[model samples]
Target: MSTSITIFDTTLRDGTQGEGISLSADDKLKIAKKLDDLGVHFIEGGIPGSNNKDIEFFRRVQSLGLRAKISAFGSTRRKHSLAEQDENLQRMLAAGVPAATLVGKAWDFHVHTALQTTLEENLAMIGDSIAYLKRKGLEVVFDAEHFFDGYKHNPEYAAAVLSRAREAGADWLVMCDTNGGTLPGEVHEIVSAVGLALPGAPLGVHTHNDCELAVANTLAAVQAGARHIQGTVNGYGERCGNANLCSLLPTLQLKMNYTCIPHESMAQLTNTARYVSEIANVNMPVNQPYVGSAAFAHKGGIHVSAILRDSRTYEHIEPEKVGNKQRVLVSELAGQSNVLSKAQQIGLHLDPSSEQARKIIDRIKELEHQGYQFEGADASLELLLREATGEIDELFTFESFKMLVEKTAGGSVVSEAFVKLNVAGESLYTAAEGNGPVNALDNALRKALIPYFPSLRDMHLSDYKVRVLDEQDQTAAKVRVLIESRDYRTAWSTVGVSGNVIEASWEALVDSMRYALLGLHSPQPVRTEFGQRGLVNH
Candidate 1:
């Protein structure tokens, strides 16, 4: 068995501190439950006394029967007030958490300048707060804020602050790289000194990523005897952000030989990252370590071909281990093997060494030269593959379409869309009104196809993304649109491109619906429920 490292997740606290990311009490509870399910050891819910929302979150999470211990965060007691009489302490206690984390200014500079108190009073506050919480039978974690910078400035004073908390029986003395400027080498040295000073207490490391080194710093601190790691999921926090547990947890378990959560379900790491982002309503970072969409994506021909031969060639770890799938993108740089493998994955069979494959590859490069990228428009690529392999059945063809929009006096816009389609030697015409021309067009197209393909009812646009192809004027911009849709079960995305935004959107929309219908005709085996499964289907 490997050594166990406690995952102290501060997603509810520091994560919410990110700009425009606010979770309601219910959202916090939902996220907390997800973390519990993910096997986190400790959930730092939030600073209960800081706001009514956090207080309510703590109150609700207390009775949640969570396997993970809920911890309420707060600063040390005020200088003039007794620990028991401190309103912040009172609120923390009232929140009824199993543990509490009390942060104190460890640096003499913060004590003098920020707290406007003498160093002696700051030490007194740390001792009193920890002692008070320990006496109340709550496990206490003392956060030594700015301890690295503090030690750099005044090593004796910083060590003295830890000594006070340790003597007061704080379970863990956490050193915070508050400014997030410390290097990994600096972290190892500072943590080593602090660990030596407070020999009996367990050491914890809380790092921010101002220099994009929080994960590296945390790893170094752990190597230097820190036992607990504090971070927010996906590194959501103020400034550059806190240490990302998504990256840290994997590195610790896979590379450092430390035990963290269950190895069997380590695959959930990517899903957990995205789940948190979805709940926070933030756009998922495309390059986030382990979980990002591009984490396992292969683009260049040489890389893609090598990956197909052996994924280990280009991948650090198996994509499935982090609930991600290896994606071979179709691009001008793709080889025949890359195209064949990707097409086969989507159930299209083509001989990689055949002329057809070479022709398709050449066509792809031609289209790419014309500003058609298959990476973001996978649905169009799939259609191309199907057409090449003679698997596509022409169910319907577009004849002509026109759209009109008018602005009303109340500042509302009304849009009218008309579409004509030819299916099985029959022409169908339909018109609809919507809030926007694209929506009206979509509605009209769906209505026209409803009579022929009733399965269209199972489809609805889930998300739409548009990107400008050229860097010139907005009017002359060649736009690419991606449309995501879902039926009763699976979700797939399609892409379209044109100089006109509406045309690009329309192409993506049609391809998305077509993919859904095709998937329904040949459905994959059931794995798990929709909400329980990860976005990447390996």
Candidate 2:
């Protein structure tokens, strides 16, 4: 029989504390619903009394009938105030959540300095807060804030905090590494000691990533008998960030033989991480553990070939187990398999040993040498393959383009662009003005092509990234531009590079629109239509 670990996701509460991430009440509810569907045991919704958004979030989420227990988060009652009379405690109760997590100072330093209270006063507050919340019919999880560092400083005092929570009838006592500086050995030692001290109470662990050891410290705590694991998806939080449940859950279930969420639903981990990021409007970390875009991505030829033979040679776990897929990046270092796989994804079939495949690989390498990275620009890579195989019709070609940028006194900068296109044995010239040279050029190009391809109206730039490849000379330097575009449901990225920023942008912009058009016009056999016609004839 295996022990079951409770996954308490604080992404909505703590993850949103990360700088530049501000989720409204509605966004919090939406993400909370997603986490509940992802099967987390507890959802730390927000600090209920902190702001209106959080207060409203609790109200909105109550109607969701979520499977996971929603926990309102707040600190313990103030030093001089009675637990029942404390405004913060009252707010948690008024939120109407079934559970609440209340944090109290476990560190003697914080007790004496930060809270301006003695160690004895802190203990009383912790006990009284938990007792009050428990009496209110809310499951109270006592967060022993800064417990690890406190244990190191005063072992007896830290254990006393756990003993206090146990006596107060708290549902679970979560030991927190607030500063996130504790090592795994220290974590194992402290959790072992605390477990012995409060054997009657359920033990939980909350760690931060200050030393990049949040995940390690969390797992060590589990091995030492702590059952509940509290963290955010993707390890998002203030400072160095919280422990990452994304990495911890998989390790515990697969490696340590602990029961986490259901094995079948574990596949939702990667998408869940991205879904949260999308709602928060934060760019997902491409290299984050378990769920990142580059988590299982193979770029080197040696590694790619090895993974193709046996994924176990390079990968620690099957990507599909965590709802992620292995990606073979087509680059200058890519092999024949990489090219073939990429071509197959775009519905293109090519003989791997043939001249066309060789040409495509050579062109990729050549473009990479010129600062075009295909890994981030798959749309451009696909267009290159089509053009190299003569699958693309040269319906129109660029003859020349020029952009003029001028700044006027006490006014905004003005840009005018002229574009020339050679199409159907005739020349179409267009001009447009915009806020910037790139914008002007884009407007002129779109104006010229909109008549021919009406689908251009559906296309728009999603993201644009510009990186200077050579930083030695600021004035004359090579730059790389990555452009992400979308046409309704489909999105694609393209890359361009040159010493001239406008030219690089133009190259990527053209490829982005071409990819969108290709997706819209590409034919697909309709099985439903064929089946209907067959039934009618019969």
Candidate 3:
């Protein structure tokens, strides 16, 4: 069996069909460059006939000199239309790309109900389109849309569709589970049967994630003799998603030993996934296989302890292989090993058997019991670690802060905050107005500290969340606030808990500023107790 597999990425085309995913021509071009850098075999840009943006992308993409062949996606001409005269086919030719992906109806039900055409006519459409594209000297990939469902319903008609495409010189025959409802066992069996019947034809597989088995099904198909695999980055697509190439590429090369992408380009997988998510304005799932933030994160006491001795005890593959690093998260469940690992991760030195390490572990459990979570709040955890070790000094001390709200007769409202701080023994005061109390407080705090710590100018809160610990306490319930702050270089998160939401926001906001200052300036530790107002002792 040939080990070389063709990777077909349909992110720009089918991935855009996902909810809330919109990419301009420029965005598509940028992603295409990244995909080329990662060494994918084919990039399905989009259907040029459907949108002017895709047409523009093709025109601009030609100048990029990418290694991957850009494939223009479209259907098999039209139901009753001639291939040469079909507008969609003409657009593909004008796209000026080297490849074409033409999806045609393989299901008899779709042919009858959706296309409202005869089965023989659909076969003719498939044959004519592939032959036309072949004559034009473009590599043609015929996507047998709904092939699995069609095969289950009528095996003969489905087999006829594959035969027509094969005889028409289609470079690849891709069996698609269009509805995304095929099981892995069924996919393997059907793909095996097709490969046997088709003889020398190059078989491919395209699947969806409706059943959440798209990746499993694709793997099964590959095991059954399919070579070309179609998927989207981060699994973005119409319904649940398409098969995720982010997960597929690694599994194929590292586990299955299938030659898919360049071995050196494998490390770019996580970056590519994150870059696409950044451009698409979507949050990459933290638990996403291989690339997610929490993919290699060890939090359990035993897991962290085992990983410290030998990472293979807890990790399947080395995280660095995919441009991700193992993270040791500290929480109530953390042991001495977790603390030691996390301390090392942050460039802090702490003896594993020392009383300081035990104290820190006990303190984390104590804080977590008070509704403070440190797993997602790395900056806060770092600050706590430093404080425990007596390394962090007070850059500034908070004296008092207040918020004011006003409502007019016109139904307009305004929020303002006043902050007083002791910076290097100088009592400084500032005030700012914002759309909300938290925003106003953040602005005011930044105003008071920017002069002392100029790095505060680049830092801004990116995300903030408040989780109420006890709904039974209603409005009086304590809330845990997590604040994510980012400067030009990196981002960090901090946590604070209080019965008053504003007070909780204040603690998190202070920790964010303190963490930023610790990186640039080192001073003596401040007073180490919480005052009556839950403020750090000055």
Residues 135-213, model 1: lDDT tens digits:
9999998889999999999999999998998999999889999999999999998888777766656999999999999
Clashing pairs in 3: none
Clashing pairs in 2: none
How accurate locally is residue 43 in candidate 1, as Cα lDDT from 0 to 100? Answer: 95
lDDT tens digits, residue span 372-482, model 2: 999988788888888887777666678998787888899889999888876555566778887688778778877766665667888888788999998996969999999
What TM-score does candidate 1 get on C-alpha atoms?
Answer: 0.92
For candidate 3, write residues 433-486 as lDDT tens digits: 888999998888876666556667888898899999999999999999999898
lDDT of each: 0.85, 0.85, 0.91
Runs with alpha carbons beyond 4 Å of true place in candidate 2: 393-400, 404-406, 416-435, 443-459, 487-490, 519-538
